[model samples]
Target chain A: MVNKAPLLEIKNLRVHYKVYGGVLKVLDGVNLTVYPGEKVGLVGETGCGKTTTMKTALAILPVPPGVVVGGEILYKGRNLLAMSPRQLSNVRGREMTMIFQDPMAALNPVFNVEQQFTPVLKHAAKNHLSNKEIHAQAVLALQDVALADPERLLQAYPIQLSGGMRQRVCIGMALATRPQLLIADEPGTALDVTIQAQVLRLLNNLVDRLNTSIILITHSLGVVYETVDRLYVMYAGNIVEVAPTRKLFSNPLHPYSQGLMDAVPKLSGGGISQGISGRIPDYSHPPAGCRFHTRCSHVMEICRHQKPPEFEVEEGHKVACYLYGPKNQEAAV
Target chain B: MSEAILEVRDLKKHFVVDHIGTFRRQPVTVRAVDGISFDLQAGETLGLVGESGSGKSTIAYILAGMYRPTQGRIHFRGLDLFSENGKRPLFLKKEIQIVFQDPGSSLNPRRTIAQNLAVPLQIHKPDKNIMRETLRLLELVDLPAIYMYKYPNMLSGGEKQIVAIARALATDPSFMILDEPTSALDVSVQGKVINLLMRLQSDLDLTYLFITHDLSLMRNIATRVAIMYLGKICEISKGSEFFQNPQHPYTQMLLSSIPVVSKDEEKLKPAKMIPTGEIPSPVNIPPGCSFNTRCPKKMDVCFEIDPDFVEISRQHFARCHLFGQTQKQG
Candidate 1:
C-alpha cells in the first residue's frame, strides 16, 4: 500500500482566516498524503482548522476571508491550490466530493431529491447522461445507501425525510459521482450511533468496492478509530501527530494526542476521565512557538521560543513535539 | 436503596402532526414519550439515553412541567406533580429545575449573569439578597464570582453552560433535569463540566435525570440507566451491568454501534446481527413491538404482540419477547 503513488498530498498547507480584528491563523503548516483506497481520519476539537484544511485542499474554501498563505495541495500530482476556477471545476465533483454534518442544510429544501441529484449527476459524469440514466443513477445511489424506498424518496423533498434518512440522501448525492476521493466532514454528528454505524459500514464497503480514497474529518474518536486506517490529530492549526489508527490509539506520542485519548469517556468502567486543563488558544494571537505549548503538560523553554520539530518515530508514524527531540534523533539515541 | 424522590408511571406525551398539502390535510399522532415508567431515587443520577425522536427530551420537558403529559401520573415526594388542582405548589416548583441542551440559546444574551440569576431567585426566594445569592451559586459551581457581571455572549461555551447550571441551582432544587448538558462543549471542556456536575451533585446531595445520547458518558456518571426506543423504555439496569451485559437486542445494537477507542478490543464492537434501518417515524409507530421491524431477534410474536417489560435478571429489566425465556426461569 505504501508503494502506491499518493492520490492526494497536502504539503506544508497554510491557511489564515481574516477576521474583524486580525488574521486568524487557522492552519499553520499541515502535511498529509492519502494513497489510493486509503481511509484517513482528520480529528481535532472545534476551531482546529480540520474543516479549513479540507476546504482548502478541495478548492471549496471561500477566498477573500480564507487565504492560503503558503503550501500546495497536490491532487494526483496537480497542484489544487494553483488551479483556476474553471480548471478546478473539472475535478471538484467528479474526482472528489464532500458531505457535511447537516443533511437538511446541505440539501435544497425546495427541490425534490431528484432535482437535487441533477447537478451532481451532471458534474460527476465525464461526458453526458440522459434524464432517464440520471434518474436511474440517483436511484442506484440511494439504493446503495440501503434506502427502503428510493423511488418514493427521490420524489420527496428534504423536509419529508427523517434526519438519518436525509443524511443518507446527502450521502447518496455525494457518492452518486463514484468520486475518487470522498471528504466526510463530521458526517455522523447528527445521526444516532446505529445509523452512524450503518454509514461507516457503507463507507467501508464502498471504499473496498470502488477503491475510493477517503478523508474522514470528524471529532469522534470512536468514529475515526473504527473507520480510518490512519489518522492525523490536528491542534490549533498544525497536524500534531499521524499514525496508523490502532498504533495511535494504543500509544499516542504527542502530548495533545494523549490528552485527547484521556478525555474520551470510556464504557469500560473507568472513572470519569480527566479533560486537559487550559482553554483552546486564540488563533488570532497564537502563541509564538508551539501553539499547544500554552496547554502542553511537558513544555520546555525551547517549545516557547522555537517550534518543535517533526519526528518520524516509526514507519508511517510522525509526531511534532520537543519531547521526541527531532527526526531520526530517537534512532540515534 | 434510597426512597424514590420522583416516581413516573405510565407516562405518555402525544403531539398532533398536521400533514399539510395544497388540497387536503391529515392529522397524525406523534407519540413522543409513550408509556414510560421510571423512578428517580434521592441523590442518584438516572441517565436516560436514546437517539433523536426517542422521546428522551420530551420526558425531560414533561418532568420540568413545560409540557403536560397526555396521560400519566408523576409522583414527587408522594404528591401528584402536574395536577389540574392548581399551578404547582411553590415548593414543588422550587424543588425541581431544568438545564437545557444549548447553553447559548438558554441564557439570554442581553442579560448579565447576575440579571439572569436574579430572575429565578426573585421568583423562588423573594426575600434573599439577589446579588449575594447569585455569587454563591457561581462559587458552588467552581466559577469565580467575577463572572456575575459578564454577559452570556462574553463567556465561552463551557462557561455559559456553567452559568446556566448556576442559574438552575438558584432555586436550590433537589432534582435537576440536565438535557445533554455537555453535548455542545469541546471534549476537554466536556470533562470539566462533567467533573463540576459530579462535584456539585455530591456536595449538594442532588438528584439528576441526565438525558444524553453519549452512552460512554452515561456509564461513567449514572447509577442506573434507562435505554429508550420509539418512546418506550427498552432496558433499565444498573450502570455497572448495563454495558457489561446488555439484554435487549436494541440495547446491544446501540452499545455495539458506539465506536470503540481501539480496534484491538473486539468486545467493543456491536453484535453483527441487527439490520440497519432508520428509526421509524414517531408519527407512524409500528403496530406491535415498535422495534420489531428492525430488530434482529424479532419473531412472529413480536410482529403480532408487543412484549411486556419483564425482569430477566436481578434488577435488570428489558422490553423484548426474547427475554421471555429468561423471564419464565426468573
Candidate 2:
C-alpha cells in the first residue's frame, strides 16, 4: 500500500479559531494521509480537532472564525487549499464527499429525498442528465446502501424516516456521486448498537465494492476496529499515534493511545480501567511542550521542555511521545 | 439472598398520540412499557439494555417517580409505592434518586456546585451543615472542594456529570436510577464516571438500575442484565451467563452486532445474526411478539402467539416461542 501515491495528504496543517479573548489554536501541525482505496480511522475525543482537520481538508471551515494558519491539503497531487471556488466546487461533491454525525441535522427536513438527491446527482452530472435519469440514479444509489424500498424512500421526508434510515439515505447520497474519497464523521455514533452495526457493515461493503478511499472519524475504538484498515489516534490538536488497526490495539506505544484503549469498557468482564485524569487543555493557551504532558503518567523532564516528533517504531507504526524517542531508546539500551 | 430492594409487577406505561392519517387525525396508543416485571435485589446493578424508543428511559422515569405507571405495582422495601399515594411519600422520594443522561441540562446553569448540591441536602437533611455536606459530596465524586463555587457553565462535560452524581449522592439514597449516565460523555471521561459509580456502589452498598444501550459497558459493571425490545424484556440473566449464553433471538442479534475492539473479543461474540428489519414504531407494534418482525429465528407461531416468560435455567428467563415450546414439552 505504501508503494502507491496517497489519495489525500494533509501536510503540517494548522488551524485556529478567533474568539472573544484570543485565538484558539485548534489544530497544531496535524499530518495525515489516506491511500487510494484505503480505509483510515481518525480516532479522538471531543475538541481534539479531528473534525477540524477534515473540515479544513474539504475547504469548508467557516472563515470568519476559522483561519488556516499554515497547511496544504493535497488531493491527487493538487493542493485543495490553492484551488479556486469554481474548481473546488467541481471537485467537492463529485470527487470527494462527507457525511456528518447527526443524520437529522445533515439532511434538510423540509426537502424530500428526491429533492435532495436531484441537486447532488445534477452536480455530479454537471447539469447534463435529465430528470428521469437523475431519479433512476437516486433509486440505484439508495438500493446500493441496501435500503429495502428505494422508490418509496425517495418520496419520503427526512422526519418520516427513522434515525437509521435517514443515515442510510445520507450514505446513499454521499456515494451517489461515486467520489474517490469519503469522509464519514461519527456516522453511526447517534444510532443504536444494532442499527449502527447494520449501517457500518453496509458502509464497509459499499466502500469495498466501489474501491473508494474513506476516512472514518469517530471516538469509538470498536467502530474503527471493525472497519478501518489503518488507524490514526489524535490527541488535542495533534496526531499522537499511527499504525494498522490490529497493531495499534495490540501494542499501543503512546501513553495517550494506551489510555484511550484501556478506557473503553470491554465485553469480557473486568473492573473498569482507570481513565486519564486531566481534561483537554485550553486551546487559547495550550501547553508549550506536549499538550498531554499535564495528564500523561509517564511524563519526562524532556517532555516538559520540548515537543516530541513522530518516531517510527516499526515498519508502519509511528508514535509521537518522548518515551518512544531516541533518547528513551538509548536509555533502554 | 438479600431481600428484593425493588419489585416491579406487570408495569405498563401507555401514551395516546394523534396519528395524522390520509384524512383524519386519530388517537393511537403507544405501548411504551407493556407489561414488564423485574426484581432488583439490594446492592445489585441491573443493567437495563435497549435501543431507542424501547422504553428503557420510561422505566427509569417511572421508577424515579417522574411518571406514574398506567397499570403496575411497585413495591419498595415491602411498601406499595403507588397504593396510598396522593403523591409519593417524601421518604420514598428520598430513598430513590436519579442521575440523568445529559449533565449539561440536568445541572442548573445559574447555580454553583454548592448550591446545586444544597437543594437535595437542604430538603432531605436540613439538620446537616449545607457547606460541609456539599464539600463532602464533591470529595465523594473525586472533585475538588474549590469547584463548589463554580457554576455549571464553568465545569467541563465530565466534571458537570460528576457534579450531577454528587448531587444525586447528596440525598444518601439506597437506590439510584442511572439513566444512560455516561453515554453523553467522552470515552476517556466515561471510564472515570464508571469507576466512580462502581466505587460508590461498593462503598455505600447502593442498588442501581444502570440503564444504557451499550451492552459491552454493561458486561463489566452490571451484576445482572436484561434485554428490552419494544416496551418489553425478551431476556434476563446473570451478566456472565447473558454474554456466554443469550437465549432470545433479539439478544443474540444484539450481541453479534456490537463492534468489538479486539480479535479475542470478536471471537467470543456470538455468530453474526443480522436482524431482518428496523424496530417497528411502538404505536404500530406487531400483533403477537413485538420482536417477531425483526427476529432472525422467528417462526410462524411467533407471528400469532405472544410467548410468556419461561425459565431457561437458574435465574435465567427468556420470552420466546422457541424456549416456551421446549419448556412445555419437557
Which candidate should be chosen as best, given DockQ against the real structure?
2
Off by over 4 Å in 2: B19-26
Write down the lDDT that model 1 would get: 0.88
Q: Where does model 1 exceed 4 Å of error?
A: A326-333, B19-27, B263-265, B268-270, B325-330
TM-score of chain B of each: 0.95, 0.97
In Å, residue B184's CA in model 2 sits off its true spot by 0.9
User: Residue A150 in model 2: shift from native, Å?
Assistant: 1.8
| Candidate 2 structure quality by residue, lDDT tens digits, A1-333 | 979999999999999999889999999999999999999999999989999999999999999799999989999999999999999998899999999999999999999999999999999999999999999999999999988888889999999999999999999999999999999999999988888998998999999999999999999999999899999999999999999999999999899999999998888767678788889999999998888999999998988888889999998999999898888979989
lDDT of 2 at A114: 98
Per-residue lDDT of model 1, residues A146-205, tens digit only? 888889999999898888888888887888888899999999887888888887787678
Clashes of each: 1, 0
Candidate 2, pairs of clashing residues: none
Model 1 chain B: lowest-lDDT 10 consecutive positions: B262-271
Report lDDT (Cα) of residue B13, candidate 1. Answer: 95
Quote the positional error of residue A205 for candidate 1 in Å. 0.7
